[model samples]
Target: MKIEILLDIKNRLGEGPLWDAESERLYWIDSLGCVAYRCTHDGREIRAWDLPDAIGSMAIRKDGNGAVVALRRGFHFLDFRTGDVDLIVDPEPDKPNNRLNDGKVDRRGRFIAGSMDTSEEGKNSGLYRLDPDLTLHKLDDGIIVSNGPCWSPDSKTFYFTDSWSGEIWAYDYDLETGNVSNRRTFTRLDTSTGGAADGSTVDAEGFVWNAQVYDGKLIRYAPDGTVDRVINMPVKKITSVMFGGPNLDVLYVTSMAIRHLPRFPHDPVERGALFAVRDLGVRGVPESRFGA
Candidate 1:
């Protein structure tokens, strides 16, 4: 249960902490800064690429050339060597107000992501699946700020959150076809308790860990959607969570620091920094790569 700051880079909107096991490196993004970052597990050899638009999330490619990113414009191929971004498609071309947000690669190597309504009021966004063939399919619609896309250890259930709704939904996942069905409410946060849902990851033991943004709580849930444990963080704007490190035992967290909090002026200076939670007594499954 030891919490320590790994990097105090002061990211404006830090999200998407991804662990690359093949290279033993970490990847993340500063959404507001329009920058993607990479570093070692110990936070060294840091490199960054300036993207044209705000990036919500990214998945490493099997070929190791770069990543398939969910940028504000749409899905694009980000080349690590040349920094060239090639657009795939804009799933929400008609809804100019919505942008791609949280996403993850399923066990079958399909990139699943959802859009978010920038206004935070409309339910015009959609959940989409990008197949290995570079084809995108719409899975669900009417979401307002999609976040925390992940699945159960057995690949039978898919979990996703619409931050504005304060509830995380579970769907029947078909690994063979990459389709989702039978949507049901898995858990609902009494925002008074843990704040809204952000990013999430499933551990090796079939537990779900989620970061609650405003309240700064990292919640671990059993497979039945019951709260198993809760860890309070030092910062309020904890944006995302992942399991990294060589052993996949270290829990990495990202946070947001968009502006000075006039209300909580005494907030810790590490609010926007990256954090590592070690000695959790648990390990995590490796994240699947896109097109792998």
Candidate 2:
């Protein structure tokens, strides 16, 4: 288990690391920077496109040239070639203060993303599902700050995080119909340790790995929601994680650069860098593509 900087490029609000297995490339977003980026497995041949607005997250399209992205305004299609953005839908037309946040593609090809209150203190957002048919459905609501949307290896259990509540919730998932129910607390972060759950990913063995923001910890949880291990990150504002590289054995991490936040300082030159944890002795399932 060795961790090293993959890219030293500082991202202001880096989040949503995704692996495109087919292309052997890595994609990620600098949320506040309003940019989408892609690079080779070894961090070479990088390319980027300026987005229309702050991008929350994105999924590789089934056809593979572009992506389906959740921007601040709503869901949109991003053409990596021409830098074009086409609107998909804005589920929350009434909640002007909320923005789409962390998201991922389900095993069944539906994109599940949650919104967060920009104020960071209002439960005015909801979780949504976007099917391949281009229809949107609301799954759950009353969320303040949503993060960490991922499912178990079997795709029967869905895990999500409301950072403000400090709790990671699990729910029953129907892969066939894209329905979720029976929500319950899976694990709660001890914020007294100075962190909240940021982003998460499930391994091929069914363990959940979460990036703890402000506390600089990467926590691995067993299927039963017990802490299996913890790795202290070099930066305090670790935002997201994903398993990339050709074999999906590398854990790629994203972090934040803004220093004057609530509790973070202006130190740690690597605060906004991208990282790769190698030789973890674990592999990850291929991320499903949108509309696949």
Candidate 3:
């Protein structure tokens, strides 16, 4: 297929585009701007909220109340009605250089998030899971930039990325026990041309659609580690992707304008933008919300 530029906010660092099925709105975050935004399917009705700190990612609540947010300092609850914020847990209070990055609620409503080092690169970061009861568990360690963290349609497999390593890994997931095993390489990037995989989402057919940062494209991959399709993009740094629209035929993508500063200086069109492509007709499972 073909990709179209739907909304070009010129976002400094736009990430985490989640489709709110009940409201028919797309929610995303501008990490550097520390703002969360909501818009319609056609890219209208823009609404934004200023967060106290940089927001890594967010998820809708099970009861349709508000959202559980992973912020730079810690995790909190965002009230959709009153706009009230409540802190849940802070995993890295001592490591000031580290900040929360990408996160999502599993099938069981447990929020799993990853952290990245804001200072130096390399594997100084780790992945943590926030249970429904608000307890935190360290799932993996020695990661530099943690991204993706999306689950398969059956909830029996998890796909996550380590951007620094340029590798996407799959883990055998135990839905009941919330445990992951059998860590193996799913895919690796060609560092010469493609940027590392950032955020990703799985479709109903078990294909993983990932946003290839610096590559200016979105890739669909089969379960056995094969490239299914690639949709070219205008911008270099694509941050994330999600399947949305009425029948989920439309795919919404978020991109970053961070690393293209000096080279493409003064070029305004390619910054933080929301993109859309049609005809996939793949429905994504509703995002899990946090609640009792």
Candidate 4:
């Protein structure tokens, strides 16, 4: 199926794009602009919320009510109806150079996110999990550009990426204990290519769909570590991807137009647009909003 350009956000740095099944809306973040956007299927109405800091990613609650957001300072609960934000946790209070990057909620409704250096040049970041009880645990360390915290459909395997390392790693996940082990290289990007792996999501078949930043493409990988398919995009930097729509057939991808090259020309229109491709038939899990 062909991918369609749903929204032209002209975002300077578009990062996370998620689909809320209950509301039938698409939510995404513009990391540099510190803005969150919501769009419907018909594309008639668009709503946006301004964040105090860069918002890396967000997930809707299990009850289909609100959302939980990963911010530069920490995580927070966002009331969709009123736009009220409440702090959840601050992972790196001492390191002002780092901030939350990409994140997703697991099958158990736990928010797992990672951190990255603000300059995008150091390995001082790590992956973290926020449990239901609000306790924060450091899952993995020594990550530079922390991306993808996606799990398999059965929740037995986890896939993560460290962009600077140009590699995507998979681990045997223990859902009961929230422990990850058996780390092994799943895929490696050719540095000669324009980009590396960014955010990713798993399909029902356990295949991983990863957004290749600076490459302007989304790659679908088979469990055996073979490149199954590549969906090309109009923009150069593809930050993230998620399955949305009621049937989960729509594949939504977020792209950024940042000038990663030392002497690259800028295209005003393609820099931060939200693009969508249809007929993939992949549905995504909802974001978990906290409840009393």
Candidate 5:
């Protein structure tokens, strides 16, 4: 399969790659640069928005108007038509040292997001859930850097990663109560080698795909936590991965130059651009909408 750059916008720290199947477009955020982009899958018809604050991730709304985004301070509803940001509750009003990070919509349409400690020295951040009715819930605590959060095919299990701990954990998820418990380790990585789990997604076949940032590795883990496949990325900071394209066979991988190998074919230009792996031979389930 040929890997190609999908966009040359070059983000400072490109994370959150999401495909809005309804519009046939891809949405992503440059976490450190305070910007977000909407583009054609082929890198054409691009539109960039300069956000007032840095955004970690966003969840597409069921109506397709815009998204519910996680910002430096809190979550807000970004209206594409008027460029307005409607305030949502800030779960951590007193914790100024924490910043929002990776997030995704749940099967029930609640926006589940997590925060990270700015200094990376304190475990002050945790996972949060933003209900469609505008209520907020703290799902977990004692986390330094929260990354991946995707559900099992049956919606009975949830997988989350603490990037700093280099471990991915699983929880028995309850849809009716929006609760997760029975936390246990699903997989672990050696951050001692400077690699940790980042953003992740699930395929229709029930496999979990995660990008190991700062280590240039993509691992496909079986439901029981066995390594199924390993993909060597061109850049070290492979922040996130998601399945897109018409048939959902294209794997859109986001990268950053925050860390890198000694030399690669595309050095500086690969700094924070999005890349695509075509005909990956797998398809992903459609993303759940924010207020579905």
Candidate 6:
């Protein structure tokens, strides 16, 4: 694929990229930076804000003027016009060691995200679902590090990954009632070929494109969990990726820089940088809104 540096922010933990079809802009977060940013696809007209906590993932509001944010504390409303934040709830207020991670808006508009223990003890992290009505439900737990919650093109299948483990799970998703069942191991990585799976996205053709945490490669998996394609990256700490661009044909990837500073001091081209790959010619559906 044709890859090029799109944004050179070089964040410590860059993840959770989303495309706003209404505003025609792309949004992402720098976890360690505790910041969320919005910028054009061409890497111009940038605007950013520092949140009170590390922002893991965010979904654009249906109203088009705000975002549903998965902050360290919990879910909140971030108003872009006024810089206002309204707390919805802190699902695990007592668990100071855990924080929200990768998140997505379901087909029905509920926000689904997962949390992981910062201590890496892997004791009490879990997957959570927040209904548009503001009710929080624990879907699963005992996770080490949670990442990636993308749906199939038809929105009938849900895919998730626990970065600590080298496996991805799939579920039969019910869009009407916001229910998931039939959990099965969709695929397990060898870890020798790639590191853990960090983030992923589904395409128009139902293929799952996942990023390798420390292996510097992005892989495309067919619906049956067979590997189809691989795109090698220039950085080892690739965190997350999303399909953006006006036509959703450009694949935007986020990487980590601080962890690789000691190994790639001379990395002037692509270490921890936001990259764009445009040769695949695949398109993605618009990100679902925060609420119905």
Q: Highest TM-score: give the candidate number.
A: 2
**Runs of candidate 1 exceeding 4 Å displacement:** 259-267
Expressed as tens digits, the lDDT of each residue in 159-274 for candidate 2 is 99988898899999999899999999998788897789999999999999999988889999998889999998899889999998999999999999996356565539997898
TM-score, per-candidate, Cα-based: 0.96, 0.98, 0.94, 0.92, 0.95, 0.95
Q: Please give the clash total of every predicted structure, in order.
A: 0, 0, 1, 10, 0, 0
Candidate with best lDDT: 2
lDDT of 2 at 38: 94
* Candidate 4 lDDT, 135-209, residue by residue in tens: 899999888889987888888889999888888999998878788899999988766865788989888787889
- lDDT-wise, the better of 1 and 5 is 1
- Output the TM-score of candidate 3: 0.94
* Least well predicted 10-residue stretch by lDDT in candidate 3: 259-268
lDDT per residue (tens digit) for residues 183-246 in model 3:
9999887767746789999888889999988777788989876899887777777889888876
Greater TM-score among 2 and 3 belongs to: 2
lDDT of 5 by residue, 50-107 (tens): 7888888999988998889899899988887877887787889999989898999888
Give candidate 2 regions above 4 Å deviation.
none
- Give the per-residue lDDT digits (tens) of candidate 6, residues 146-254: 8989999888999998886779999999888777889899898879754789889998899999998778889999999999998988877788889988899999999
lDDT of each: 0.90, 0.91, 0.83, 0.80, 0.86, 0.86
Whole-structure CA lDDT of model 3: 0.83
- What RMSD, rounded to one decimal, does every model reach? 1.8, 1.1, 2.0, 2.1, 2.6, 2.2
- What's the true lDDT of residue 184 in model 5? 97
Model 6 lDDT on a 0 to 1 scale = 0.86
- Count clashing pairs, candidate 5: 0
